[model samples]
Target: MTSAPLEPFAVTIDFATGALVPDPDVLDRRLADLDGYFVADIDDPGVGAYTVHEVRVPPTGNNLLSSTTVLAPGKVGDEYFFTKGHFHAIRDRAEIYLTLSGEGLLVMALEDGRTVTKEMRPGIANYVPGHWAHRSVNTGTTPLVFYAVYIGDAGYDYATIAERGFPVIVVEGEEGPEVRPNPRYVAS
Candidate 1:
């Protein structure tokens, strides 16, 4: 199967409702469920609350040029499925998340214990600065999906978050999922 430069591709509906909403058995990337995540609530670690399908590029010296990540929707107990947030290993490298469809929030935290949350919707772009740790949640009934572009060399450092999780976690709100301080964490 010889391919050409800038080959046109398509995005299919792979998942929704926390299930593997496969794309009619088409497309070429492997659908994988992320492993080893930190559950905000220790008692109920609802595994596989969400899934991810990504198109990753190989290393190109300094960094990979671009990549795409599509996250499926689900939840752990009352909390929504969210990306295990992280700060870039390189520290100075920032990232952008452009919402392609659905709805949710881009929750961020400053090192000084301050936190911020922004709504995500189609046609909106969230600029994540270097110092904050960022994560995305699926607040909509449908699969909350988005496309992301980031530096190739900017690897993910999930340990800092793994050890000292995010300051707040989004849980089922009466109106929708709302942000609440993580009880497991004691601010110091």
Candidate 2:
């Protein structure tokens, strides 16, 4: 396999809303009908709520798989829209996320029961070590966007999160979005 160029790709697209992200192949994720354990009873938002655009690269040359995450602005009841948090299937593979635009928070849950959250804005980068399950929450009124890179073989274990929800949920607050303990969450 030919090695991919490390040089920057000229393709430009708005990361916040994925203005020009390739279509017919985008992988979308939605929280409208999740078990409703972390959110409230609500109408389905369908599958267009959020999307993952896989960046084209040499499939056999690089060990890293890159993607741009476009999270829509809205609410699942009082809770903000968020990524379905996951721990890498490889267990020892880490991931990195850099904010492109908009505002949000990256919430991370550890097996040790500790939860950490970081505010996101343009140019901010969050490094998630192995063994942590992380989710991204859109706290602002606009779309939340970011770039992420993780080991190609890492694989996401979303089922574990579905079984064991995050201990905290981001909700609208008087000043801004707040992170509060999830009433329905039971730590595993």
Candidate 3:
């Protein structure tokens, strides 16, 4: 018996030569439409100070451009799944977290499940591997805001992670809420 030929993964595209690259203009239009669709709470309960805005391109093949705006945790009382915990992924790449406002804890989960939580303030930045499971929490009375930029695919495979719910470790409790991956995170 013979097996069928495997399909090659078309992840990267050539732009200088005008290959099968994603259209930038098309992506800009989509991002503009998503200016303020969803928002998340940081840690404050008084107001919805901390929020995440999605600026992502399509998640089809690969080569993705995306960003998220994390507002300072405020008085918003909405239940955000990862408010007390963190999350991660399966692919390998580079990620940057740049603080935009206030202060908080930046939690990164190790391969063994143990987490390395860091104190972050405005103007501070941190970098980690793409596959590392991680999350941010507002530890201060003020909201902690930042931007997480991922330089990889925008497939959003983890968008359904919250819907499926995963067991998580968190501060202030032994058990935490089930978290789904962000929709803006394009899964490779």
Judging by lDDT, tell me the better candidate of 2 and 3: 2
What are the models' TM-scores?
A: 0.71, 0.84, 0.49
**lDDT per prediction?**
0.65, 0.78, 0.44
Candidate 1 residue spans exceeding 4 A from truth: 1-47, 58-65, 186-188
Highest TM-score model number: 2
lDDT of 2: 0.78
List residue ranges in candidate 3 displaced over 4 A: 1-50, 60-64, 71-90, 154-188
Return the lDDT, model 2, position 58.
46
lDDT of 1 by residue, 84-163 (tens): 77888877677888777778999998766689999988878999887778889878777676666677777778888776
Q: lDDT at 17 for candidate 3? A: 19
Ranking by lDDT: 2, 1, 3
Model 1: per-residue Cα lDDT at residue 170: 90
Error of 3 at 27 (Å): 17
lDDT of 2 by residue, 44-145 (tens): 757446787787654332467787888888887788888888888877788899989789999999866689999988889899999889999988878888
